[model samples]
Every structure is written in C-alpha cells, then in structure tokens.
Target: MMNRRDFLKLACFSVVGTPARSVFDRLTGKDIAGPTKEGQPKWAMVVDLKMCASKPGCRDCVDACHSIHNVPAFNNPKDEVKWVWTDSYKNIFPEQSHRFVSVEVQTRPVLILCNHCENPPCVKVCPTRATFRREDGIVMMDYHRCIGCRYCMAACPYGARSFNWKDPRPFIKKIKEDFPTRTKGVVEKCSFCEERLAKGLKPACVEACTTKALTFGDLNEPNSQVRNLLASKPNIRRKAYLGTEPKVFYLE
Candidate 1:
C-alpha cells in the first residue's frame, strides 16, 4: 500500500537503522560477549639481575631471540626489529635534558623487548582485535588479523611493538627452523615464544642465554623458580612508574 517515494524512504531508513541497532548492541557487550574457560594457565617471565652480566658473548639471548623470530637485520633504524635486542642506556634510556644532574645509570646493554603487561594498554586501544590479551596474561598479536593501522603500536607505552615498513623476508637469511617469516605492513613483537611454550619448551632467548640470566615461568605459580628468585633477590621492573606491571623483572 506504500507509494514509490514512501517505499524508497522506508528502505533507506531500514538500512540505516540496522547498522545503528548493531552499533548499539555492540556497545552493550551483546556483540562480543563470551564465557571465560577455566584451566587455561597464565605464564610470566622473571629476569634475574644478579645472574645477568653485561659482558661480551653475553648477547646470546638477543641472538637467540632474533634468530628464532626471523627478525630482519636492518642497520638503518627505519626498518628493524621483531622479537628481541639489546640497548644501552644512551640508546634506550636517555637522560632528561632539563635535569641538572642526571643520575641515569649507563649499565650494560639490557636486553630490551616487550614486557607483555598483564593489563596491556596496547590491547585496549587496538581498534582491530589484532593485539589482544591472552587468557594466560600474555599480550599477543595476530599479525594475520592486523590491518596495519599502527594504533596498537602507538598505544604501547613500552615501545614493544615494531612496524614492518618493507618486506622482511629478503633481510632474513638462514632462517631459524622454528620461527616463521613475517610480511610487510604488519606489527610484530615478542610472544614469549608461544609456539615453544605449547611444546613444553622454554623460550629461545632463555635457552640461548649462557649465563642463565633469563628466567621463564608462571608468575602466578607461587612455587615456581621465578617466584623463588624474586623472593631472594632485589629486582626492579623497567618503568614501574608507568604501572604496566611488566612481567620481565631486572636485578639491580
């Protein structure tokens, strides 16, 4: 019984109304609601300071992590990084210029990478669920699902995520047997070797460290070695003031 113009208007309204209704539902958590499954274990890492030394050949951790992750070796800063690397204070942590006397410590190269925060701001800011918090308390990224928005990268306070500006496959030579190659225009970072962890193996970086400086275990587990180590040693997390509550701990 509707006229031509009235029918057309009704159709347009229906189309618009459907999307608006969907948006309202999403806001009410009706779109993404899900039940949390029990028995999924949470994992965390603790780095022991007393055991870690900044000597040469001590970069096994860096080498191991990079090789396993198939990270590109771009000397230029523009195209670099994936999993792990070392950075000096002058490089990673610079002193404030306004401060009269900077007490900034220039300790040996601290192996710097993702902290995998328990409550990751990066995950919350990602428009695409590319970066998400796993039930195990590890912050993970699904590069395949990522839309190259770079929102998660910017949201990260720790500078953990790296953007692949170009094709990474060409730079990687003699690819490690365990790691997979990443493509361009995606964000990547350390996943704490979830693949290895699934196999009941330690992270490549932890295994590669000759000094056994890196400790990987469940921080939630009271009887774990990392927990015991924290009890005995004086440790600090990088930028605790940020309240990221990083799983990686450093010994002073």
Candidate 2:
C-alpha cells in the first residue's frame, strides 16, 4: 500500500515529464529551477586559514551563525544541529594533504558549513523537493515540505545537512523571532545567510569574525574581493574531486 508520502512522490514524478518545470514547485510551494541565466550575482565565500588561525579557538563565526538562525543547542552529539562549526584540516581536505604536509597545517581548525555547491546532489535526491537551489545558487531547504526521508542527507557528500531528531525549539537557548524554529522530522543546513543578503548585510559569520578571515561576495563579479582573493591565493575546496564545485574556498 502506498503511504501518503509515497503517493505524493509518485504523483509529483507522474505530473511532470523529464524536461518540464519542476512539478514540486506547485506541489511544494518552492521553485526547483536554479540559476537559469548568466551574469546573475553568484554568491561565494573565501576563508583565509592563516588569518583564521591567528585567532585560535575563535567561536565568533559559529556562534553568530547559530544564534541568528535559531539553531538548537542540544549538546548531544546524536541530536546536533549546526549551521557552522570547525573541523581539522585533514578532515576537511583529506585529498589535499600528503605525508610531507606540515603537522600545523594538517591539524589546523577550519570552519565548516554548507558549501552551496554549483551542482548540489542534495537537491537532486530530495523526494519532496524540500531542498532546492535558488537562481542565485544558494541551496535552501523548506522545512515544512521536508518528509524526513533522509535521502538528501545521504546524497550530500559534505554532510552539511542535519536531521532534527526532536522538536528543536526547546533546545534553542533563545529563539530569534525573525527566523522560524524547525520541528522534528526535518532536515536543515546553512543557507549562506540568504536572509541577511536580502537585507544588504553580509553573512553573520563573516561579519562576526574579528580577524576578517571570511570574505563573501558575488563570485561572478570580476572585481569582487572574493574573486580577487581567489585569483591571488592558492585555495582549496572540500571534496572538490567529487565534482561538487563548492562555492566556499579555503586559502591555505
């Protein structure tokens, strides 16, 4: 017997032919067609590891991102909900390291978040179209449409998305009224601070960094700081060989 979710999924695929507009747009109330034209401002971020390392044990970026987004602080590893956090260099860029790599570089703490890849596999695997990429290239999730199928979580190589094991509002120390708190049985992740971008402000993490290690701007703009940094610095992306084309670049 087809369950409600199964019926919806089948109905969505049935209504839309292979090449038509996303059937889930009407069904899920969100557009799945992403980045149709050229020259639109494609958002990206650059993280300078040297500068970030200068301020060792800095949690400004992580705290700022989580507070503004209303991310829960479950404190349990099993129910962790993180928008931004840190990981060791080798863990972040396993393919970029070698035996000759300096120990300092290998174990350096690097900020981690959704890379907002140009070709996001999560969007492709989301059965309910809960996850989709915007025309500006920001991968977003509609929590309401999410059926907690966990397919997107399995598809994302970066492990950026988090599944809410329980209602998250209670765990949030203080809810940001502007952002909606997510319920149990949904997936969420960094949206590249699209809300702040819409308000002509930078991402929470970038603005909160005292060392100015994080840079955010339009990747399509030749004169943008992010573009200029990428041009002048040797940068690496997490799991780039997977062909994700991650917009977040780390200058090591």
Candidate 3:
C-alpha cells in the first residue's frame, strides 16, 4: 500500500503531468474539465451524521472552507455566498422526515454543498459551458465565461451555486492568494478544493472537521474510506429519486 506521502506525490504527478491540460485546467488543477466517464477516479464524500451531531454548534468546517475559498460574508441571506453550510434535516431530506420523527432527527444539522452529480442539470443548461463536470466527477465553474445568466443556478436543484450580485471582493475579510476571488456577475460554488487536491491535501472542510465527520476519497478505490463507509453503514443521498446520481452520501 502507498503511504500518505507517496500517495500525495503521485497525486501531484497526476495533476501536473497529464498531457494536454489546458491553462484553465492547470489553474483549476483538474486533469480534464468535461463530462467524466466510468472507470475514472470518481471523487466522492461521506458525511457521518452521528459524529457531526456530537458538536451541536460547531462551524469549523464551514468557516475553514469559506475563509480559504474567499466566500464573502454578506451577513445577509439574500447575498450570502456559501460553499458549505448546515440545514435542517427535514429541509435536506423531506422524504426521510415525518411528524413522528424524533426532534433530534428532525432538527439534525446536515451539511450541504454541491452534490457534483453524475448527470448535472446545471451543466446541461449552461449555454456557454461555464459550469462543467470534470473527469473526476467534480462540477466546476469558469467564472470568466459565466455571463451571470443564472441558468446554472436555476437549473441546479440543490441551490448550490451562488451568484455575485455586486462586487464580492469588498465583503471578503481577507483573500487567500492561492484562490481567485470572483467578480460581479459571476457564479461560483464548491470545487471540492481541487487546488488543494493538486497539492495532495484534503478539502478545507474535511480537514477542519475535528470530529472527522467528513470523509473524502475516490469511489473507484475498493478500499477507500468513502467506499468502505458506504458499504458498511446505512446512508442516504439528497434527492436520489431525481436520477442525478449525487456523489455525496450521508451516514445515519
């Protein structure tokens, strides 16, 4: 088995050494930015509900992901730029909820983000191809190409994409040099920390999770943590009936 260091080294090589990677692809650290097919290294995430529920008021993952990605804090829901945030259980899983459901289950804080679905509706509606699913199953956006049409946002069922109503740079407390801040009239959402993945690091949210509630790995790997967790534990995906084939799974 490859050690962590070795794994990271190989990851870096795969990210950098891949042939014909365009400038945008290099900038985003995605091998090839387009529709991903089967047999590729499909990225996925698994959220452990019990572990996350242990800390009722923790926003460590949200804060870390936002701070690193330059997600502006409008302090208003109308203009909030959220890469990751918690939601009520019922809102996230309406089919899983009932009046008889326990309060703990009803009000469970479920982390939500872009599901990076295999058949992303947002990708299909994008006239300019601003948002496309990478070969690794990561849904990514080209901010420069986004005409603020909001097609992707409207097509997205998860409400994952955030549009810049105005200049967002002013709202950021401090910008991380590693990532670019979006301009007005562009759409943005979680990229699963693709740049960090290129550096062989986990997503900021997953790493910042002290309770280890967030698990990320390639679903194609037989022994991957996410695959193992999915196999051994009962889990659910948001809106699975829609046939989007969401990659993010939640453990109950």
| lDDT of the structure predicted as candidate 2 | 0.88
Error of 2 at 38 (Å): 4.9
Q: Give each model's whole-structure lDDT.
A: 0.74, 0.88, 0.89
lDDT of 3: 0.89
Q: Which 10 consecutive positions of candidate 2 have the poorest summed lDDT?
A: 26-35
Residue-level lDDT of model 2, residues 26-117, one tens digit each, is: 44433444445777889999999989999888999999999989999998899999889999988888888888999999989999999998
lDDT of 1 by residue, 1-252 (tens): 899999999899899989988888656434332233465565767765436654554778877778778988877987776577766544444532233433344544567778887657677667888887776767888889988998877877778889999998888866776667889999999998888898999988899877777888876677888888889888777777766668887765
- Top-TM-score structure, candidate number: 2
Alpha-carbon RMSD, candidate 3: 12.4
lDDT of 1 at 207: 90
CA lDDT for candidate 1:
0.74
Candidate structures ordered by lDDT, highest first: 3, 2, 1
The digit string of per-residue lDDT tens for model 3 on 1-252 reads 999999999898788856435655544433233554667788999999889999999999999999999999999989888889999999999999999999998999999999998878888778888888888888899998888999888888899989999899999999999889999999999999999988889999999999999999999899999999999999999998887889989998
